[model samples]
Target chain A: MDNLKIEGTKQTPEIDFNSSTGILSISGRSIPENTFEFFNPVLLWLDEFSSIAPEKVIAKINLEYFNTSSSKYILEILKRLRIILKDGKDILVEWYYEEDDEEMMETGEDYEDVSGLPFEIISIDDE
Target chain B: MAKQSIYQSEIENLEESKNFLKKSDYSKLELQMEFKKLVENYEELIDQVKIITKISDRLQKKLNKTNIALEDSNIKLADLNDQLNETIDQLTEAKIGRKAATIVMIVAIALFIVSEAFIEPIIDNMFPNNFLVGLGLKLVVAILIKPGEDFTNKYMLKKARKEQLRESQLSHNNKP
Candidate 1:
């Protein structure tokens, strides 16, 4: 149950998953050259985390942009969280977008509809 | 172990199913099982297609928004650059004008001193009684002052432009 921490890059997002606190946060752009390679480890980690997950898990996602392939992997992540919810775990997704980014806000709404996870779509000022 | 790509796995599965159908030696029960597996794969593929299409379209919208923002930033940068160049041009002209004025004034002073030291004696020897001749010489120097200033101004302006161009080219080359 070690924490998962990845530094953000120009083309990839940062990943900070704290098992102890049950606060999983991902932020920044995600346009990796190998989407599968980049996300496969994340999936593996989630698979392990499912059994040992805390009483409450909060996933904070603040993505500026992501490619189509990354979108699939995002769904896969949500699917894992859905499995946790099925196990009677309390979980929620906090989807953050910039104030002016209508597209991002709508995309968050779409994920909320499809993933069946309680989502809070929050808008923040541009940095 | 390296996992197979999604498309590769799908293609391999489809090929295997096709081969299974082509083989005529399969029993009825075996054929039904194989068909069932194929149907299952087909359904999963349809589900993947549904999600991928929706996500792809939404991501495309996000990309379009980013592209528009980038274009707007570029336009603003270009406008600011134009304003900066205009200011540089005005400053260069002002500097050149001052330098030209200084050179003309220095030349006029030198000419005045030389006239008193050499040209006045020469005038005395040639036309000592002719005040008009001395007046004409002074008038000639006064007339040349304007053209001298004009030449100096043009030369300085050209040099300033060349230096500015070289500096801009160097900056362009240095940019990543």
Candidate 2:
């Protein structure tokens, strides 16, 4: 499968999913004008990746902020990851938040509970 | 057109299930499977709602706190700007006062020189017995000194304020 790469903007996050490495990363703000349009390709890519499932998959998510619709799409992405986990493949989700952002840390915990995926809630220094 | 939603696919799936129950002719086993699927979907939907609501509210609180901090910073910045402008005005007034004093002193010295060289001689030739006229002329110059300095100070301050206003407007216009 071809790797997926999307550039980050002021209103959107960067997406870099490498099929060869089984490493998926999303970072920056996500407040897209069209949530479905922004996420549909990502969902389709995950579905494709699931068929040719790799030995280990890692999803790194680091977001400063996201709107409500973007939040729903994030949940959808985690659900797809859960499917991959159920396929007997090793899966890990690394959720990064700034050190001072207590709310973001709690958000990662909430996602961990909701997704039921193995998550490493990591704190990063503020830039 | 209907507004696009992130939940559109989920909503469609639920509608499909509803329609299947209303119209599909299914065996008992098929019915049981469909019911299970429906329950699972419903459970997932509920979980999504619960988590999304919790996250949205938390982020909203964070946003509100940030806005309050931004407002406080803006107020402090405005206060500092006012203080700076007042200091500049005070400095400008002191500078203009000094300039006005210097100009008045120079004019007083020039008048003294002219009176001694030209006016005193003419006065002595016309009124040989009266020495009070020369002293009175010098006294008039001294009396006008305060009002002359006051006028110069007012003029220079007005000009300085006008220049400051013009520079500010130019800077505002030039800002990208």
Question: Which candidate number maximizes TM-score?
Answer: 2
i-RMSD of all predictions: 3.0, 4.9
Interface root mean square deviation for model 2, in Å? 4.9
Error of 1 at B31 (Å): 9.4
**Model 2 score (lDDT):** 0.92
lDDT (0-100) at residue B86 of candidate 2? 100
DockQ of 2: 0.51
What value does DockQ give for candidate 1? 0.39
Q: What are the per-model DockQ values?
A: 0.39, 0.51
lDDT of 2 by residue, B1-176 (tens): 11246777678878878888897488998888889988988888899999999999999988998899999999999999999999999999999999999999999999999999999999999989999998899999999999999999999999999999999999999999
Off by over 4 Å in 1: B1-44
lDDT of 2 by residue, A1-127 (tens): 8999999999999999999899999999999998888888888898889878789999999999998888898998998889889999999999999999988999999999999999999999988
- Expressed as tens digits, the lDDT of each residue in A14-108 for candidate 1 is 99999888899999999999988788778878988988999999999999888888887788889899999999999999999999988788889
- Please write out the lDDT profile of model 1 over residues B120-173, one tens digit for every residue: 899989997998988888999999999999999999999989998999899999
**Model 2 misplaced stretches (Cα beyond 4 Å):** B1-5
